[model samples]
Target chain A: MTRQALPPGTLDDTDRQLLNLLQEPLPLTAHPFAAAAAATGLAEDEAVARVARLREVGAITRFGPFLDAAAMGGAFCLCAMAVPPGRFDEVVTLVNAHPEVAHNYERQHRLNMWFVLACERPEGIARTAARIGKETGLKVHLFPKLKEFFIGFRVVA
Target chain B: MKLDATDRRLLAATASGLPLTLRPFAEVGTWLGLPEAEVIARFAALQAAGIVRRIAVAPNHYAVGMVANGMSVWDVADEAAEDLGARIGALGFVSHCYLRPRSLPDWPYNLFAMIHGTSRDEVEAKRQQVAAILGPALRASDILYSTRILKKTGMRLVEGG
Candidate 1:
C-alpha cells in the first residue's frame, strides 16, 4: 500500500486542520477566530497565537482579505516574452521593475517569462506591456481572458 | 459597488494584512483611528460587493507541500470551450481555468487552466485528467511548469482614493 504524503514544514495535525479552516473565509464578526478556535479545540488566544506563529515561520504568506483586482476596477493582463536563456535574469529584473507587473514567473516554454500586468485602468495594460517590451527588446504577447471559470483556491494542508 | 474615501482608507490600511487578535477588526480600526464598528461595517460591505474575495490565510503552496504547479493550455474547438472550461474549473485540482484568445502561429492555445499538485508527476497526472475531460474537443495542449517566481505580490491597491 502507498504511504500517505507527509505534511510539509513543522505543522502538526492541529496546525494542519487550522490551516484548512483558515484558507476559507473567516467569520466577519468581532471574534472571527472564535468558531475556528472551537472547531480546532483551542482557546481563542491560542488560535490567534498559532496564526501569528504560522505567518512568522513562513507557512502562511499573508493573513488578510484577498481583494479582487478586477472587482476593484483595476485591469489585469497576462503577458509572455521569449528571452535568450543567457540573459534571463537581466530581463527578469527589467520586466519586474515596473510596479504594474504584479506577478512574474519563469516557466518552461519558448516564451519563458510570463507575467501579469495589474493596472489602474484598462488602458494601462497596453502601456505597461509596451514599456516592458521596449526595455526587454522582446515581443510582449498579451493574453487577456475572454472568460473565466473561477474555481476557488483551496489546498488541503 | 463604488468605493468612497473611507473604503479606500480601509483597504489601504489593511492591505498588508489584518491584525490577528480576538477583535482584529478593532485593532485595524485603531490603526486607521476609526471605531471598531466602522471597520467591521466596511469589511462587511466590501465583502458583500465581492471586492474582498475572502479574508483568510494565504498559505505558501511550497511550504504546504503543493510545490508543483503548471499552466496547462489547450487549443480547443471554439464552440465547446465554454462548456469544457467550466467542467475543468470545477475540478478541485484546477484553481484557475479561463478561455483566452489564441495569438496564432507562435501561440495557438485559447484555453488555460492552472493545475497544482505535490510533485511534477502528480501534476502531469492531473494534466492527463484534464486531457481526458477535453477528449476530442482538444486539438493541442501544453503544460508550462514554473521554474521560478520572479515576483508575486497579489494585486495591491497603488493609487490613493
Candidate 2:
C-alpha cells in the first residue's frame, strides 16, 4: 500500500519518533523530553521545537496527559438517536450545546446521531439523556460501556 | 488519591494541552508557581493512581489517511462475550473494543469495536475477519460507518470549571 503524503514540510523522522515516544508515558523526571530527544537522535531543544511545530501545524491535536473521567469520579456513556435529515443541523446545535456531550458524530444508519456523554456523576448520564430527549423530542438510547477490553491507539506518524 | 483544589487547577491548565517544551514539567511548574520536581511527582502519582492515563500526543486520524472508520457492533453469547471481546480488542486494526449493554428489543448488540482503514471495503474485510474469529458465538453484528464528525473532544467535565 502506498503511504499517503504528510502535510507539506510538516513532519520529519525526528518528529515521528518523538510522536511515538509521546504516545507512551513521559518519564517522571526534570527533563522528560531529554530521553525522547536522545532516543530520536536529536538534541533536546530540537525535539521540543519539532513538537511545538507539529502542534502548530495540527499534526498533534493535543500534547498532555489523558485523564479518564471514570477514574476521576465521573461517568460516561455512548448514545445514539435518529434525526430526520432536515433537522440534522438543528439537532446538532441543540445536542452540542450540552457541555456533557464530549463527542457527536453522524453515522450511516437509522440511528444516525451518535455521541459520548461524560459527566461528573454516574446519575448525571441519565439526567443528561433525559434533558437531551426532552429538548430534541427524540428517544436517546444509552450505551454505557460495561467492560472495556481496550480503548486506545498509537498512530505511527 | 482524591483531587483537591490544586489538582483541579493543574488539570485545567493542561486540559487543552500541555506546552510542547523541553522542560514541560518545569514550564507547568513555573506557570503554577510550583517546583518542577513537585509537578513531576504529582503527575506521576496521578498516573499510578489511574487518574491520568498517559501524557501523549493525540493525532488526527483523518489527517493520517485513516478515512474509513466504522463502529462494529456485535451480539454474542452472554457467557462468551468477555472472551470474544478480549480477542477482538487484541486485533491491530481495532482501536477501541468494549462490551456495552444492549438496548433490548430495539438494539441487541453488546460488543463494540472501532475499526479504521483506508476504505469501506477494508473495514468490511476486517469485520469479516472478526466474524471468522468469533465463529458461532457471534449472533449478529453491524458496522456503523461515521459519515461526519460534528464535534470531537477529550472529555472535559470538571464541575463548575
Candidate 3:
C-alpha cells in the first residue's frame, strides 16, 4: 500500500506509536511487523509505513539489530581531533573511509572532531590511531574509554 | 516499551554482546532456558513497545585505522539550529546528531554532532566543512574529546538495581 507523505513536525498518534516501535524493535521474527502492529494497536501496513516514513525523515537512522563488538572479541575506543578552519570536511572523509571507524561527529571545542572505532583486536585500536595521525599530519588524541559510567540513554519524547 | 521478565533477561544478556555463534538467538535461548520461538516472540513484543532500538553492527573506528573523534557542541541560533542540524546529520562523516537543551550558566550549545576521521587533521577538515556550512551564525562550539574507555551497552528495559 502507498503510504502518505509525512508533513514536517506533523506526527499524529499513529506516528508516535510507530516512533515508539522503532525505538525498540522486536527480535527477528517471521512476522515482526505484524507483531509490532498488534502491540501498538495499528495495522501491519500502517506500522510498516510509519517506520518507513520515520526513517525517510531522519527521525530514525536505521531499523536493524544492535551488535556487541566486545562480545565478538573486537576492541573499540573513542577518540577526538582538533580541526583547524577550512579542513573539517576533508578530514571527515579520510576518517570515514577506514573500516574500523564507526561513528564520527563535529563538536564545539578545540578538539572538535570525535568518533568511535572498533577493531578485531584490542591492540589494533592504537595502531589505527597512529596511522591516522601519520596520514592526516595532525595530532589525534586517543581517548580509550577508561570507565563506562552511563552506557545508553533514551529520549522519551 | 513495557517489558516482561523474559524480555528483560534477553536484553540483559544481549545488551553487551550477542553470542558469537551461528545461531546467536538459539544460544541466547539456551541460556534463558526458553524455546527459540518464545524467545523470539518476547523480543518482538519489546520492539513493538519502542523499548529496543536498532540491531546493527557498529564499526570500531579505532580498529580499522580511522582514529580521531570528538563530541562537537554548537551554539547555533535558535531559529536555524534545526535546519543546520539536519544538514550536518546528512553528512556521512556524522554518525549521530541531535538537538539538546543547553544547560544554564555552563553550556549554551543546543546542537550536537559527532564527526570521526583517520587523524586529527582529517577530523579538523570535516569540522571546517561543517563550520563553512553554518557560516557566521555559529557563535561558539566545543569539542570534548573522550579521555577513557567506559561501559558501552544497550539499555535494559526491565527495572533492576
Best-to-worst ranking by DockQ: 2, 1, 3
Which tens-of-lDDT digit does each residue in A18-81 have in candidate 2? 7778777777787878888889888989888888887766677778888877877778899999
Strongest candidate by TM-score? 1
In terms of TM-score, which candidate is stronger, 2 or 3?
Answer: 2
Error of 2 at A114 (Å): 1.0
lDDT of 3 at B142: 69
Give lDDT: candidate 2, residue B119. Answer: 78
Weakest ten-residue segment in model 1 chain B by summed lDDT: B152-161
Residues A35-114, model 3: lDDT tens digits: 66788887777766766665545455434455333432467776767877588778877877777777776655666676
In terms of docking quality, how is candidate 3 classified? incorrect
Candidate 3: list runs displaced more than 4 Å: A1-157, B103-106, B147-158
- For candidate 2, the C-alpha RMSD (Å) to the true structure equals 3.1
- Where model 2 places Cα greater than 4 Å from the true spot, the runs are A1-5
Error of 2 at B35 (Å): 0.9
Model 2 in CAPRI terms: which quality? medium
Better of 2 and 3 by DockQ: 2
lDDT of each: 0.87, 0.84, 0.62
Q: List the residue pairs that clash in candidate 2.
A: none
Candidate 2 achieves a global lDDT of 0.84
Total clashing residue pairs per candidate?
Answer: 0, 0, 71
